[model samples]
Target: MLPTKMTEALNNQFNNELQAAHAYKAMATYFSDKGYQGFANFYLVQSKEEDFHAMKFYHFLVTMGEKPVIQGLLEPKSVFENALDVVKQSLEQEKEVTRDIYSLVTLAEELKEHSTKAFLDWFIKEQIEEEDAFRTIIVKLSGIQEGGEYFLKMDEDFSQRTME
Candidate 1:
């Protein structure tokens, strides 16, 4: 059984993951509107991944004998000045997720919930990869001019990104 505080926090994380999915979908549409198919594909994949993450929380809650609560999400930003702007915002989002995961881990530690803490280790590793991926994208965008060969190549590479 999950402690009350841990249950509430996990539910919040679950909702945040859904919100991240919503945000990524908005970003996908932004890229698609601009005719950047590759970029759109990348964000689309991200949106799906967020959904998967949310489901993990839902299942965890269920297995822990708690009912998961669904909550509303804030509206995502639709306007971005450039690819760099989008990447920066995504990096910030990832960092926020990382923070959330860390908070959950800390809660588990405080509660002496070893099972929960072990489960959260996966998310900790995931956040590291998520932040690293966005940071890498930011680096790439910072070094290239939009509509240039390098940018096009990078987009093409991103288009190949598949959810594992």
Candidate 2:
């Protein structure tokens, strides 16, 4: 069973994951509207993955005898200057998510919630991959001076990255 505070925290994380999914879906729409279908599909897949992550937390909370409460999500930014700018924003968001996960781990440790810490370990590892993946995209985008065939090739490359 989970402590009340831990349960609340888990629910908050679950909601945040859903918000992340919503945000990614918005980004996907933006990309699609801008004629970057590959990038849009990439974010669509990311949205699905975020939903899965949220569900994982939801299931964990259920197992702990807590009801999950999803909250309102903020609208995602849709006016990216270009594809590279969108990728830059994504990388920054991923870094922020990594920090949030670390903070949650620290909070669990401070609360002596060992199970929460253990549960968060998966997210911690996931955040590492998430950041690394975006970092690679940022690196690739950094080399392209303009959005043209290079950007298209970059999109193709980024599309190849499966969300495993």
Per-residue alpha-carbon lDDT of model 2 for 33-102, expressed as tens digits? 9777778889999989999999999998998788999788887887878767777888888787788788
- Please state the error at residue 138 of candidate 1 in Å: 1.0
Instruction: Give the CA lDDT, 0 to 100, for residue 19 in model 2.
Output: 86
Number of backbone-clashing residue pairs for each candidate, in the order shown: 0, 0
Candidate 2 versus truth, CA RMSD in Å, comes to 1.6
Candidate 1 runs further than 4 Å off: none
TM-score of each: 0.97, 0.91
Error of 1 at 99 (Å): 0.8
Scored by lDDT, the top model is: 1
Residue 31, candidate 1: alpha-carbon lDDT: 88
**True-vs-predicted CA distance for residue 14, candidate 2, Å:** 0.6
